[model samples]
Target: MAGEQTGVGIADPALEAAAAPLLDKLVADGVAGKLAAQDPTLWGSDAEAEASIRLSWTTLHKSSRPLIGEIEALRTQLRSEGIDRVVLAGMGGSSLAPEVIAATEGVALTVLDTTDPGQVADALAGDLQRTVVVVSSKSGTTVETDSHRRIFAAAFREAGIDPARRLVVVTDPGSPLAELGEAEGYRKVFLADPHVGGRYSALTAFGLVPAGLAGADVARLLDQAALVADAIAADSADNPALRLAAALGAAHADGAEKVVLADTGSGIAGLGDWAEQLIAESTGKQGTGLLPVVVENKDAPGFADAGSDATPVAIGPATGAAKIAVAGPLGAQFLLWETAVAVAGRLLGINPFDQPDVEAAKKAARSLLDNPDALRGTAEPSAVIGAVEVYASAGTTGEGTLADVLREFLATAPEGGYLAVQAYLDRLDDASASLLRSELAPRAGVQTTFGWGPRFLHSTGQYHKGGHPNGIFLQLTGAADDDLDVPDRPYSLGTLQLAQALGDGQVLAEHGRPVLRLHLTDRAAGLAELMRAVQELAR
Candidate 1:
């Protein structure tokens, strides 16, 4: 059998033996009620955030059973109000869950998680008269979310509609956003459990309200999620979540630095963004983390062929491989990975609950806006290769040629390190990202990750700069065919996008990371050439 056809699968027979000892220990710990005890020292003796760490465990239980009435009421209310669409504007944890749920369930919802003007404009492009604008933020002060709220609120008013009547706010109790929602007379305000953290709040009001509003079966989803808690509490080897945790922890210890994930079924792919943030932010501190790289099923071999150092953990059915399959188990997946990340943190001896370095880039980007002089090197092409041109930072060694810079970057990657493909192009095709991932990792003999620009600056960007220093950064940028301007800012949306890229690159360099920037006159042709270059280098 490839894996458990019902829940999650870690089917390798050898891994069963390797994982038994750890699984036994963890099961014993849970059976003894240690895991649920909310001890801060679970990760380390000096761990300081016990209160926050303990809250995440209760989220599954509290959210699934207790919040059913509130969830149903809101769904009924939305239907009666004739709301046909909902636009959720949030970032990271607040936005990823709804986006995944909307995709899996085929719901009428749009998630705006970027500060890119193009994305914001597209999300609000629909008819606002029938759309409920959900300005969602756990803290109520995320710069991107706030910007989206202001822009859309004004647009609604300009259309002669009452902004308050068409708006809803979901936030923690008494948060600045909740207060503002009340003051602004939003149509409704849904307060989340104060103790639940954003990432772990998938089963909470943050996700349920939006999922319900979008027409998903909230009750069934909760029922499925609750089973995860029960299985975890059972503390047995047959327990799916605990077994997965054991495999992940044991694999990382055996030198599989990269935890490559690929979803086989249609529903499983939707879990990528949420899984990335969950694993990256949770275990990425202390310079050791099980880097969770989400790959499409077809592209699994790219990382699988990453020599001896890589560990490819399949999340879906593949053609020929004994691998884990967490596909088709939507609610269980959310809890399963959440459990795995916490367990991995314990095994790695790092605090799983805190994200200590996520604020640095935000601060850096804000500083760039306040001081234009600090925006790093100009966005000019240093060398032209067919349709592409390469740019290097001021002190970069391979100054004149793009190939030289790429070769230097690839060679300098530490043993077992990963390559990050950060594309800042407006119209990059998913096929292109997949192709790059499939072709790069094996040749480089290291794990590879890909994310579109500006969006990634909010997610894995933290790990690249602050988690560990073993990353090679390849930035791909191109000219937009069309550009949109911010409502009142001095720069166009395109300009802001470029500034964000440069600002993040600057931060990476200051941290002594390997960084290279490529500019393309024609993105399609440039991407093809890049793939060829990588293939040749690998040979």
Candidate 2:
């Protein structure tokens, strides 16, 4: 309710009405086909499946049905056991839904979505006595989740707490995680129905975070979700989710090829990243799909409003200049985007929820860890360069060229360590190439990574000015036309200008590192050029 807004532009009642028939068709098909045909073994009993669906639908509709007794029993058990913090450990859909619930419910919780050792170290460093680690995976073998679990378990052991005491696992009953949980003598384990895909598990523990936290009536949330289900089932064009899908589908069909997810708060900001994985993995196939772009809406419209047909799916309270008025609107926007993505996936004949490339990165990172010495040969030495040449024509063709260039650069970069940021990855390929070059460079031989620290410098002025500079620095900035006028006194373009002045080329110059400054009128184009130049220079 806090983040919803209405009437940025007048509502098209006619357009809304047109989508009803399709929504009806989809619901009927879903209930009669997917939901009805689901195997009992995968979802528990028939009654359990029905209950899960009802609960999911209810929450979507904002109703007040409480969760059934079994769920409540689990929550009570957790409370009685002195579990103050519940960690939902999973990746992608397995974790995103629960994350949304936790953020929305205002529960004190921490999520470990990354497999990075540093992240695991931080989690382990925290007080484990009161922590309940919920290791969630549908298949029981998400590489990242498993890796992090091992790290956390080792940490728990080091902290003197029995690993079982701090662990609760949610996974398919016969799956690896479930088997491991039982064998390891975990204190409690919740087995998700194998039939229910990770993305679709929200009705279960996936959507139970808010209910568990507020001690809110689970039944009520279930009721709300059930209402949504019923509405979806009815198949009327008035179904917001269905209509949204239709609108998004039409846009994609008509060639609006990018989706920009913008979020203001820390909790919801990560959702953008999750959405990126979802959309890209699910729909980007067969040469037709919206490139899912994710970015934090920190009063910056750079990524959100970039393309001509860019649609902003705003999440949670409008803390910035978007000035959205209601949570209902934000909810509507989400449903719209979800529908759009679903439709796009349908158009591409692909599943909108699964991500295959996600594992490749994990595998590569693991392999790099396995053979750290292999990185030495791949590492590139720092060097100055000249202007990068562009070979492609303008518009879409140019975008494709940039993407190819980025892929080529990333393919050759070393496995680990920080690189400089020339452009935000949410934008075009040139920016992505810059990021890949800066962040993915091999640390085997490099002494320092260079990049301008405008945002960090502004936010951490005291620390940067006084703290030790153990890393390399590269400063990048440009004079570009502003996308939006800042209305508040504190929000000025000059702030960025001053940040650049204080921390950009001159800042790196003072630190006595090899600093390079390239000024251009167009930020996006300039970023692209800088990326190409870096690749050529680094090569």
Candidate 3:
């Protein structure tokens, strides 16, 4: 059961049986060339509805193979030009893959996925002459990536450097970003295949260009991905991706809504982040989705115990684990989850390719940018202690105290409900988030989720607003010691972050969600306040 025959080491008799019929239908429908005609049912929609079903397979094509050589050539050229650091300016699908590769391979690549002014400054801290910035977005119109390009391009010009020499673009063909890149004299423009969605673009230029620029063996990564694609084509129980998909579908059917991922090896450190965006944005809709909670350390006290509706999956170097490699395992995982989530979508009766709710917050943030006065009206603090401010966004009509408000909200959590703790701070680590979950889980009597500002707005925020009304939301944000203005925009990075936070709150409030807002003087104080609040509630 633990041998290579299991492929990625997923072995379960019940799940295999449950998946047999669906697997057979898929195979007979011409998946992996098992039959003549194609099967649109595999993606839970017709060909007209879900057009990007097999676009992921393009990465394995002979035609796409040549791009590996091109990426290698570009890598060599950048090295020759003495570029030491490569900063990836993007978000969600565009940034997650490169972040994982850079972390796994120990490359000098930094992903700026946040609007925190401190983060913007930190990403551009090094010498402009020695750095190359890769601006990536599948839509070519993501506000965060565009803001990054403008700010950094301004910084580059102010330093007496040619912004074009230090800039490259990765986006879909004919996207506005592509035209802008060409007009601005970009060093190179790698257009991704238009059919590939952002979450599925890891194998496209969106991911490879950054990974290659950061010195990863792009060829090897693709080689590993091809192997997984072959396994999926086999469409057998032994196929790792199929087996994993069956497991996920079966688990979901059995009422395991919380999918807890434990990523131990540094090889796939950022895999959870990538998978979070994919799983949340894809499967989360119509009042259902997989709530993926990535626990950095499973042995950390409270996480070892899961609620009744939780599924614990471990991905690391142990025997029967996903089996870590320098880069192969991560690539294998990128394909594995992509296939599994699609299959899971079929099981859940939802379209896995579309994200309808992700645009609401984007639209709201833009409206704030257009009319800054519309950002007026702060909710009176329900409670302010020390440098922390707390405002209940939902279910505030019957509150006695801030603690009582939290207690009342937690008390009303429906069976199989979850708590989402959103922290809008400069810190990116999940230690505090995870720690707060440790305290809140037993007290709230439900599973807990922790996400930083704006980033989660693009990912799980969809589920919180559109999916089941079972999420109890708590948002925490803080002031920064230093704030940098967005180049050519009326607001600073800090203000944009707050606007995005408030915009999301407005949307969630409009949807009748139970949300509580908290503002702290700074991140350190914010995290401490969150810890104290959880500890008090735990009592």
Identify the leading candidate in terms of TM-score: 3
Whichever of 1 and 3 has more TM-score, that candidate is: 3
Candidate 3 displacement at residue 358 in angstroms: 0.7
Model 2 error, position 485 (Å): 48
TM-score of each: 0.89, 0.58, 0.90
Instruction: Find the 10 residues in a row with the least total lDDT in model 3.
Output: 318-327
Error of 3 at 84 (Å): 1.3
What is the full ranking by TM-score, best candidate first?
A: 3, 1, 2
Q: Which pairs clash inside model 3? A: none
Per-residue alpha-carbon lDDT of candidate 1 for residues 279-300, written as tens digits (9 for 90 to 100): 8877777777767677766447
| Model 2, residue 60: C-alpha shift (Å) | 10
The best candidate by lDDT is 3
- lDDT per residue, candidate 3, 86-122, as tens digits? 8999888888888887777777788888888787887
Give each model's whole-structure lDDT: 0.70, 0.44, 0.72
